[model samples]
Target chain A: MPSELELQISPIVQESLVHNSRTLQNLQSLTASLFGVSAGILGLESYDGFLFYLAFSLLTSALFYLVRVAPSSLTAGPRYFRGPFEFWAGGLMNGLAGFILTWTLFYGLVRA
Target chain B: MTWISKSITTLGGLLLAHACYSAREHSALQSLRAASAASLTSLPSVTTSLPLDIIIETIVATFIILLGLVLGTRPLRPIEWRVWAGKIEREGEEGFIDGAGEVNKDYMGNPFSALESRPNFVDIRKQRREFAEWVKKGG
Candidate 1:
């Protein structure tokens, strides 16, 4: 989190912040369901399934950074995101429900 | 660029669907075999997991889809006010175009444009002269 003084020194654009976060959230939610489908096809269960979700979601963040954030933000460090945590791990909880929903549906479909 | 991502995503979806179908068939075949074996003898039937090929296909397809999705996402804007304003000044409308080659609806152009083109500073006589010349030339 940036200090109030730091924020005042360099004011943030609220519209840009919202745009960036919304883009990331959209990608995370879409890929979370994709991961779940693959996990289901692999017959992963319980902890294994959750672990698969964790690993792949992290991979998604890394790929997103490489493709988008890293190109323009090499020197200043992710100008679109507020902090490292927001860029990397913020979407974990946002997509968990969608992941589980598709996981169980596909798991049952494949097994049945 | 948009088409590239869309095609890649479609290809990945096809591969994933095929893998899912293969896994389903494999499980169904295993269950059928298990039932036959159980009826034929007293020994318990062995359960088989998905083939390695299917697992690999599923994982690879997922990765391709992830790449496509990341590529498909809209370009992000700088969060800092100065950086954002500078981008608008430097690139104008070109800076805010989306994947479809259209200007973003939210793009309002230069924020300080009102100050730059204040109506109060306009030369009324200069505008009236231009309008009169146009009328005289045609009408």
Candidate 2:
């Protein structure tokens, strides 16, 4: 079922995959911490307003960690999330989450 | 992102801190909705004046944000490794990784083992190569 264009991984690349796997695990843990902080910051005052914010935060965390960290390196990237979905998605999530949390907090203060 | 990440995180963090400090109610009301007859009597006439609590919160938030901006760009006490290893971003949260995967205790806080066994030199060499390649790739 392999396509002709699908490049076979080299042995060194295989070894690198193991280390990268560990690194990805570390990255996932770090990401969870960041998202938890962001979500708490967003939802701290009122429970109702930031459902999307918190939901997106959790969703992004799960997607990135599962796709990028839990899978084998072959699935992650020939280029380490930079090659495909994770790259842009990761950046977008970060931007949106950061924006919403910050925006709500700032405006919320003004209202207060 | 390079320009805005620090500012946003700092400012956002400060604003978040302010929210934590201010009025007990975090209602989404655009205005003080306790604008009913009895509540209207309770509302101060010069309502535009920022409450002292809000003022203090704002001041604290400002200081925190200013400090974060200043320190984010500057080098404090150096870690075991001089280089920053990597970064991860997701859902608007981004973090940096530096000074990781060390071996020496004096240099990097390793446990007393120098009474220590030999390290896997070959693996380290290979990892070093991959890490070098990672840098070359502009990661």
Candidate 3:
């Protein structure tokens, strides 16, 4: 069930969904590569490497929102964010697998 | 055609990866020679190779390039009418009625008669008149 806040905002549109998904994909891929580089440089290992990725992915999501979204209206309409999940924190979960793949590759290469 | 294109793309990607790996290997060998010139005998010669960073970067860059090429080359299919109509209606700030349905219904009953009648020629004189009217009105 959608919350009252979700109802107050404009309904999600297909075009916006398509556009946002493409943007999210680009962000995930770029951030994944960056996370790999940082992890390799920092010499993080095993569990610590994973933790670094988690923290950075969330940070990337926040930064993406602040840079791309927050300047616009928040609660009014489709002119702002796509939806609550996309606007706030869904990018972190979306980026996780890509981040892990790159982080592992970098960690193995650097530590080797 | 799609299958052929997919196969070609796969082959191209493999060739690109192989070419990138060989180029990196050659550069690494050259760098090793340059490093040896400074009397760095302590450096491991036999195991000398491209750094992990470089290898990862080459692979990632190649992958992204190939992915972009594949995606970019794929033919764009026509948008569905409902989706197109919805977009048009939204932009126009109006409700959409399926105009095609009315056309189809009319054409279905008298298909042969409609096919027999040809469309009129371009009305150049009327267009000139409209342009003259526009100029007269300071449009």
Candidate 4:
């Protein structure tokens, strides 16, 4: 979090912050279900399934950074995001429910 | 760019569906073989994981779809006010367009436009002089 004094000096654009985070959230949620489908197809169970989700979620973040955040942000620190945590790990919990939903559904569908 | 991402996502979806079907078939076949073998020799039923090709296809399809989605996302804006305002000044609506090449609906250009176009700043005398000149020259 930026200090109040720091924020006063370099104000934040609320709309841009919302737009950037919303874009990232949408991508994360969509890809979480995709990862779940792949995990199900691979017949991952229990810890294996969770691990797959974790690994793929990080991969999604990395790919997003490489594609979207890295080009313009090469000099400046993550201009679109509030902080590193918001850019990277914030979506982990956001998409976990969707991931498990699709994971269980496809897991049962494939096995049956 | 939008069409490219859409086509890539569609191709990935097709690949994922194929991999799912292959895995289902492989599982069904394994169960059938296990059933027959158990009936003949009283052996424990065997369960085999998805084949390597199916796993690879699923992973590859997922990655491709992820790439398409990330590509499809709207362009992000800088959060700091100066950076954001500078971008607006530099790129105008061009920088704020989405993947479909349409300007975003929420894009309100130039936050200080109201200040720049203040009523007090209007050149009423110049406007009146121009109006009088036009009247004198015409009927």
Candidate 5:
């Protein structure tokens, strides 16, 4: 039996939600790696490298909202952002591990 | 691909990984020498001699891993109304519901509208008894 919550959401809305999440994951991971490479090449130290990653990943999230999510989703939901944590802040945290991994590897390389 | 093909590919990858690992170990000493000469940081250098090469390697590895994640996984199948509706209507030769199911006989009216005017427990029991008789009679 379908629950009241399940019955309320249309199939199209479900599909859109899934699609948005997949796109966001791809964007976040890719940008995190790229940011790591830039930090490594620039020879940024520990604190500065992390700061750079945080800033860039937030930028990626903002771009994702403006370009892909805003026009289609603005009128439908009660939430300000499409997903949780309101875009930039959430994506920055989500991508932090990936960013750190690449950043550390490259930092070791350039600084050494 | 088939299981055999996938296993073969995995074995090939394992071989490549082993080879790279051995090569990386051999080059580590040389890289350390290069690292010590470069800057003030005492962090150990990886396989590459130059910083640019390391950056490029990181980028390429990221792209490859991202590509594998996107394409290597099985895609999700979304549930759609039309597909289930077609199965209910028996419009095609093949559908999700099999012939053994009791629902093979199509309902005459919109089924959802009937939800508001549903049969009571007594009515349902009486209908079940009638269905059992019909099955016994091979109808």
Candidate 6:
């Protein structure tokens, strides 16, 4: 339901996509360091819940960035996302990332 | 009575959440401690043998969050007309725009009249008016 006047997506969407793709790549790389699985095979792994969410985040981010950065439609996604989905997804990403960080650091101290 | 009721509700909620968390932690630590204490033979300890996979996963996740927070820090510069209009084009500065269209720099380092586009304090009101117009137009 975007209006005709809004021409481009916001920079935030591109930023989100970059952030998500990087995080997924980071996670994929971590599998190798922690489990000795090659990075290539990890990329081929089936989409279970965690992997699915991870992949979703990456793909969506990439798609958002791709659509947004094309000069004309950059603001389109942001305009459409003036509703709950944007707010909710942004919240989820921030919240999950924050929780994992706080829990791990404090828990790490406890164990150490 | 209203204040007292609200205070009691808040206190109850806090106590309930605290108790639940304490219970979870206490069970994990207390049982492990009791089990270790009951062991008759003293074995040489190397690593803690806690599940490394879970630990690392948690740590990595936390670090990702922290990295975002760390990187997301933004500067707090206040926006002023002289600061922003300088971006469009200085009064007489020069720079290459897209597709070979050239722009002159303003005193602001904007592509405008690079020499004098930046306002002296003498023209603060004019600068504010221009800035207001820019903001009204969604700049």
TM-score of each: 0.93, 0.29, 0.41, 0.92, 0.40, 0.24
lDDT preference between candidates 2 and 6, better one: 2
Model 2 agreement with the true structure over B1-139: per-residue lDDT tens digits: 2244366556757674555544434433324554553465765533333345654554345334433332233111111111111111121112222233222222222223343445743468788999999999999
For model 1, residues A29-103, the per-residue Cα lDDT tens digits are 999999988998999999999999999999999999998999889987438988898888899999999999999
**Candidate 6 CAPRI classification by DockQ:** incorrect
Clashing pairs in 3: none
Residues B22-105, model 5: lDDT tens digits: 334435666667668668666655544434554445434433433333333222212344433433355332332222333323
What lDDT, from 0 to 1, does candidate 6 have?
0.36
RMSD per model, one decimal: 2.0, 15.8, 13.9, 2.1, 11.2, 16.8
Model 2, docking class: incorrect
What is the C-alpha lDDT profile of model 6 across B15-109, one tens digit per residue? Answer: 43343344345446755765686685476433233343433433344234323322222211112233234424432333223112444221234
Supply the global lDDT for candidate 1.
Answer: 0.93
Candidate with best DockQ: 1
Off by over 4 Å in 1: B119-139
Quote the lDDT for A36 in model 4: 86
lDDT of 4 at B69: 86
**DockQ of candidate 2 relative to the true structure:** 0.03
Question: Distance from true position, residue A60, model 6, in Å?
Answer: 22
Q: Report clash pairs, candidate 1.
A: none
Compute DockQ for each candidate against the true complex.
0.86, 0.03, 0.04, 0.82, 0.11, 0.04
Off by over 4 Å in 6: A5-81, A106-112, B1-9, B24-38, B41-139
TM-score (0 to 1) for chain B of model 2: 0.30
Report the Cα lDDT for residue B73, model 2.
30
Candidate 2, residue A20: lDDT: 40
Q: Write the per-residue lDDT of candidate 4 for residues B28-121, one digit (tens) a residue.
A: 8998899899889987876766778898899999988988888888878889999888888788889888877789999999887788799999
Off by over 4 Å in 5: A1-12, A73-86, B1-139
True contacts kept of each: 0.95, 0.00, 0.00, 0.87, 0.04, 0.00
Candidate 3 residue lDDT tens string, B1-139: 4455356546655654454455445565666686786476665545444456645554454344334333332111112234333444443322222222222211112213454455665677998999999999999
